[model samples]
Target: MTQTLRFLEDGLASDQIVALLDLHLREMHAWSPPCSVHAMSVERLRAPDVTFWSAWDSEHLAGCGALKHLDAVHGEVKSMRAHPDYRGKGVGKAILVHLLEQAKARGYSRLSLETGTSDEFAAPRGLYAAHGFEECGPFSDYEPDPFSYFMTRTL
Candidate 1:
C-alpha cells in the first residue's frame, strides 16, 4: 500500500483521528488492571508540546502518532495507532520512522515512550525494540507504574 506521512499541526479534529484514539483507549482498558490512561483527548492532543502526525493511503487515514517535547534534546512518543484496516501493512512502522526523523530534525538526541505491559502491547513494544529503543526507567513526568513499560533510544 502506498502511504504518505505528514506532520499535523491541527490533526486531532478529524473523525478518523478521534476514532483511532477511541480504539486505543478501548483496547488499553481491556487489559488486566487497564494499562493506559484515558488521556489523549482531542484537547490534550492539541497541546503546545505535542506534535502530531497522520499517515494517509489514498485519502484514507491509515495511522497516526505523536511526539511530545520533554526537553531541548529529548522527546516522548504518544498516541501511536494504526487503523484496523491497515494493520500488518507497515503503516505503524512508517509513522514511527517519520516521527523519529522529525524528532532528530528537531535536535532531539533521545526519545522515550511508555506503553502497556500487556499482551495488547506486544506488537508496539516489539516495534520500538526493533527501532533500537531499550527498556528503560521512566523519563519525563511519568512515575513508576506496573502496568506501563518505559523505553528509550538515543539518537
Candidate 2:
C-alpha cells in the first residue's frame, strides 16, 4: 500500500481518527493505573504545542502520531497508534519515522516519550528502542511512575 504522512490540524474532527484514538485511550486505561495513563485526549492533542500527523494508505487512515514541543531543543512523542486493521503493515513504524523527522526539522536536539511498562506496551517499547531511544528518567512535567517507562534519543 502507498502510505502518505500529512500534518493534521484537526484530526479529532474526523470520526475515523477519533475512533482510533478512542481505542488507544481505552487500551491505555485498561492496561495501566489511572495515574499512569498519560494518553492525551483528542482535544488536548489539538493544542498549539502539538503537531499531529496522520498516515494514510490512499483513502484509509493507517496510523497517527504527534510531536509535542517541550522546549526550544526538546520534543516529546505522543499519541502514536496504528489502526486495528493496519497492524503488522508498517504503519506504526512509518508514523514514528515521520515524527522523528519532524522533530529534527524543527531543530530539536532531543526526542523523548512516555509509554507503559507492561506487556501491552512491549511492541511500542521495542519499536522505540530499535529507533535508538534509550530508557531515561522522567522528563518535562512527568513524575516517576512504576507503570511508566520514559525514553529519549538525541537528535
Candidate 3:
C-alpha cells in the first residue's frame, strides 16, 4: 500500500470517513453496554481537544485515528478504525504508531485508551498491548463500565 497519513480537522465529512465510523459503531453496539459508552458520533469527535489523523492509500482512505489531550501530561486515544478492506494489512498498526509518535512529540507522559472488554475488541486490546500499554483502571472522566477495559502507557 502506498500510504500517506495526515493530520486533519473537520475531516469526518467524507463518505469513507462516515463508513468507517459506522462500522465502529456497529461493532461496538454488540459489545457490553459499558463498552458501548465509549463510542461517539462524528459530531462529538470534532471537539477542540481532539486531534484526528487519517491514513490514505493515494485517494482511498485506509483508516483513521484520533488523540485527545486530557491534560498537560495525559492523552487519550479515540476513534481508531481501519477500513474493512484494509484490516490485518498493518493499516491500524501504522496509524497507531503515528498517533503514539505524535503524543510523544507533544511531551505527553502517559497515553490511555478505552476499548470493549469483549471478543470483538480483542484485536484492539492486543494492538494497544503490543504498543506497551498495560491494563489499568479508568482514568480521566470515565466511570467504571463493565464493557470497557482501560489501558495506559508511560512515555
Candidate 4:
C-alpha cells in the first residue's frame, strides 16, 4: 500500500499515533529486558536532537520511527515499529529508509541502532543487514549487553 510520511514534532499528538507508540513500547518491554530497551519515549523524541516520523496509509497510521542526532557525524535510529494492522506491509522499511535519508541530509557519516538479539528479532536483524547495516560495537552512550544487537552503516 502507498504511504505518506508525516513529521511529528512532539512524536505523537493524535490519539491514533499515541496508541501506536504505546504498542511499540509494550512490545519492547515484552521482548527485551528494561535496561536493554532503547526505544525512546515521546518526550525523548521531542528533544532538539531527535526527529520522529509516522507513516500513514491514507487516514490510518501504518508505522513510526525516529532519528536521533548523536553528534556532528553520527545518528541513531530509534523506535521503529509497524502497527499490528500494517505488519509485513513495508511500513518499517519505509520508515527505515526515511530515517537513513534524514541522517544523510544532516551530513551524518554513520547511522547506528540497537535492537534485540532474541530469536524473535531475527527478521529485524535481517532487515538491517539487508540494508547494509552490519553488526558493530555500541555507539554513543550504549554499553554491550547479551540482549542487545548493535548495527551500523556508513551514511
The TM-scores, one per candidate, come to: 0.91, 0.95, 0.91, 0.93
The lDDT per prediction is 0.83, 0.89, 0.84, 0.84
Task: Estimate, for each residue in 1-155, the C-alpha lDDT of model 3 and write its tens digit.
Answer: 52455445446788878888888887677666634568777888878888887788777778889999999999999988888888999888988898899899999999999988878889999999999999999899998878789999999
- Per-residue lDDT of 21-111 in model 2, one digit per residue for the tens? 9999999999999989999999999899998887777778888899999999999999999999988777788888888989999999999
Question: In model 2, what are the clashing residue pairs, if there are any?
Answer: none
lDDT string for model 1 (15-90, tens) is 8888888887777777736434634766788899898887778778888888899899999998888899999999
Write out the backbone clash pairs for model 4. none
* lDDT for model 4: 0.84
Question: After aligning candidate 2 to the native by TM-score, how far in Å is the CA of 27 from where it should be?
Answer: 0.5
Looking at model 4, residue 155 earns an lDDT score of 78
Q: Is candidate 2 or candidate 3 better by TM-score?
A: 2
Worst 10 residues of 3 by lDDT: 1-10
